[model samples]
Target: MAEENRYTFTVRQATEADWPGVIDALTSAFEHDPVMNNVMGGDGKSQKVRDLFGFQIRHTYGPKGTIDVAVTEEGKILGAALWISPEGQKGGLIDEIRALPEYAKVLGAGLLRAAIVDLKLLAARPKFPHWLLYTIGVHEDARGHSIGSHLLDFRRFQLGELPAYLEASTYRSAKLYAQHGFVELFRFKSGKPVLGMLHPAPVTQVSKNNPAGR
Candidate 1:
């Protein structure tokens, strides 16, 4: 746990019971995200936006991955990070589609089109075995307190010898990931310039430093 002013921040694996808070936090965090605005197609505060993110959170929670949340000592959720291991990546598309039926009913053909565009953008990226940092969101009210940094550091510690990957939706976020040792691999020319980043394992860095170990 860490402290900043009146808040004591702690990171933990989110449980099913945390779903409501998680959805709300993420929705608030991504409310102004360019890519999300493009896909959601509105002021980004509509019921469709909330339902879309709710569906995503529900589907992405499982044994093969984890959704970690940053909370205050008072139990207020301030942020969330979703990570999918290499094995979890295999059927992620199918799982996401299966989770989208209800949302699709509400969002209609626009949702399907958006999903395809998102998949195509993802497919254009390099494929390799790495932990996927699917999403990281900090509540708007909690932005300047470094809650996002704490969440990223928690995952970095857990990752250890494994590489981690993510597609950042904003340049500001891409810069934050860069500060945590991720290097930009590519950038997509969509509604927003989505930047892909890869964080190589700490072990890889150590091995490079000690040639004998290699």
Candidate 2:
């Protein structure tokens, strides 16, 4: 286990090289979400979903939309967070992901569901530029040690001045987001809540205090 004062790791932009590990992490993380099972199918659907997501993210958007990976001293992927800048293009990944043969049918259905929910939510809320928090998953064994919080912190650090957004698939995660200063923007299909947060740009004073620039 990584110690408190010595949680040594590096955060880097994820690459195609990280796809296999990200797939495995996403599978493990979402396996426990009953709604993911209901909508996308269960663990049985994990591989297809993971493959489609990885392909779309790595191939379509490339690094302009960031995927950050946290790796341990031993070079194991501890956790990851995917973010899309509010100023970046939207829905390209959705089209690419929905076009995958293995996932096409369910993907279409899921989007249709999202469309209805998105419309309803939009009707009640003011539109804001958002940094879409597509996914965040940590290895199961790493839970309860602030790994999740650390991952979010790392992503916020990377974002600098960007605002963050996410749709939480579980109530527990909504609470977690609340704890981290995210505001509930709206509730969507299946009771999932969309959250909005912002990360302030790093202060020059703070960076000046560090021996090395972070």
Candidate 3:
């Protein structure tokens, strides 16, 4: 049993060398998540899931995006968060097509087809110039230690006035986002409901504090 007070970890930008560990953590964390299982079309630990996440990490970890990891003092990766800046929101049909070969290889043609359709449906939502919280996962053993909240808080602090966005695939996740100040924008119904949400920019709070518009 990992106790929150007894455990301590640091959250930092993940490096390429951290990819394997990050993937492993995410796989373990989301293995039973409804949306992840639906998207990857398998038990989340399948090679398909790993390949899908690897593809996303590769594309989302440069100047336009980042992967942040929470690691123990001894450098054990315990959780990860994937975020994409406004400039990285170029995930249109072309990007989906480009990802097809890899997904097809891992997931097979049928699952790949269905997954692409789901992706397209999700992508149909209106987008704004806001930071996107693509995914966050904490190791099962580390669940009660507030690693997820800490990662979210770290991003919120760094983002300051910028807005953030995500789609919550389960009501439980929606509640988690709500606790973090995200408001539901809309819900899309596939086999299950997905709540799209936005954490509006902190500009109002900034103005409230400064009053002089500084």
Candidate 4:
């Protein structure tokens, strides 16, 4: 017999009311992420980390991207995923200018480095249209569960023909992404190494009704 599953949760698109939970989960999730620390120092729980998540979640990705959350039956948020839909892939220059003040607040003197990191990632990304997984994080308390996998699959299946792309910050994450059909395109060094991968659009038809393939 297969091992019994202990945790139960569902992944869904995040809404305005879920921003706090989303930020908390992501802050905890990326608390120690190498790429995250490289861009914004301090483990993942600092005010800068919180502020960085707040700015990205509410102002940047939230408006022009898709945000997904994993929640238990009682409605406690376990993890969150931030994404930039292909439609909004190339973020507007206006958006970047508008984001300067907020980025300054979170990054301070390091804002220039953070901007450089963003430019580097942008320049490294594939030229074709694809969904960008900006970041996905799980609350520390919920680490052992398969919440991250669920969050990734939720959007991956619903994406129709669009491929998905993300920079895997660690070897473990890169392997995990590979398990889900993501293949590394290249690796680049910033503060930490980043492995850029792509999950090409599936060859078979992905049902509209059964989006998650459940």
Candidate 5:
């Protein structure tokens, strides 16, 4: 008989000490993106995938922010999500997005503000506070285990019903986002489609039948 594969992992809010692992996973996940290169603009190099993830970790998750992780029982870092909430803020969470260099270069001040208005309009309904899921990734060695979906669910529990948003870098990931209840709100015309998606709550269904392993 074939040996059975048994592995178990869980998701939780990432601590400051988890930043390095998160960065490594993110770098490994996005190291070969032609569209990201174009988005960088100057000579198509903005920051190393690792460095960019590191900077976002430092800038956004510093004092009081949100970053969630999925880790194996044996302590392997599988996936992560870095995000922010605008519950007590005067406006939408897109303000935090505008502070990121990637969004700044692509979206002008007027467009940014206009987007914020749209965000506010959608999230102003009762029981909704906006969140920005800046980045999420699953490590190559741990891809098939539904780790990404678990990480997203963990983030939702951490943030408690806050509407979440993210920019999907690939159609594969966009489909993954959709599987997790993220609906595309916009798409950027570029080397590859960059999809912006939103979800009123985290997705609960996770498929363990797919072939997305590394």
Candidate 6:
């Protein structure tokens, strides 16, 4: 089972023009994700799921935070990662209210349920100045090629000394993150369990001489 990993794809900041590719990769990747299917009321191919991802990417994330996509030299996108700056966290009730219409579009009758699940996940996040690894996914066709790892590597480099927080949608995804230095904080269960993980700042190593590791 083997060949070289594709260094062919280079990660770069995404643009509005990249929406089609980004959405394709995201939807394909999460096609079988139970939590997402439950939220969108169908599989990733459903219009509801596509609409929600589009809303977040094109409207909120692109304008407010950062979205990075991995593209090959020939211009094919293999994956995308969305991040929220510490100052851009939308953990406020006002922000949630603002997104009501959009969430309602995809969630429809399940809006409240989706909101509750989102609140549960949000509440599990650490309250600190850190980047939020909002969402990341690799196209189904590109899985096993290490695209996910490359994306995470770029984020780690971009992060510098700042920590990163994320709620891993599945244990499998959590393991992938663990390889990149994230440790599980807690597992929140609201039907499907999500693992909350954090990649502590490199500064956590400053405890070399200190007895208790901060």
TM-score per prediction, in order, is 0.89, 0.70, 0.85, 0.88, 0.66, 0.88
Report the backbone clash tally of model 6. 0
Q: Write the per-residue lDDT of candidate 2 for residues 1-214, one digit (tens) a residue.
A: 3353435666677787876776667667776665555455344666556655566566544555777777777777767777777655456446544655544443656655544544454344334655667678777766665667766776666555445667676777778767765677656544544343333334445665874866
After superposing candidate 5, which stretches have Cα over 4 Å from the reference?
A: 1-6, 40-47, 87-129, 157-161, 191-193, 201-214
lDDT over C-alpha atoms for residue 154 of model 4: 88
Clash list (residue pairs), candidate 5: none
RMSD of each: 2.4, 6.1, 3.3, 4.8, 9.3, 3.6
- RMSD (CA, Å), candidate 4 to true, equals 4.8
Clashing pairs in 1: none
lDDT of each: 0.80, 0.61, 0.75, 0.81, 0.63, 0.80
Global CA lDDT computed for model 1: 0.80
For model 2, which pairs clash?
none
Clashing pairs in 4: 31-44
lDDT (tens digit, per residue) of candidate 3 on 1-214: 2336857788888988888888888877887877666655555445666676777777555445888899888778899999988777776457757766765766675565457655655565555578888788888877878888888887877876779888776888789889999998887757344788889887767686999866
**For model 1, how does the per-residue alpha-carbon lDDT over 75-105 read when each residue is reduced to its tens digit?**
8899999888888778777776775777676
Error of 6 at 165 (Å): 0.6
How would you encode candidate 6's per-residue C-alpha lDDT over 102-155 as one tens digit per residue?
A: 778767897987887777877777877899998899988889888888888887
lDDT of 4 by residue, 1-214 (tens): 1111655788999888889889888777777888777777556446788888888777777878889999877777889999998788665556777789978977898788788887888788888888889888889988877788888888888877788899888888888889888998987855265689999876445555577889
Off by over 4 Å in 4: 1-6, 203-214
Please list the residue runs of candidate 1 whose C-alpha ends up more than 4 Å from where it truly belongs after superposition.
97-100, 205-214
State the lDDT at 59 in candidate 2: 57
Ranking by lDDT: 4, 6, 1, 3, 5, 2
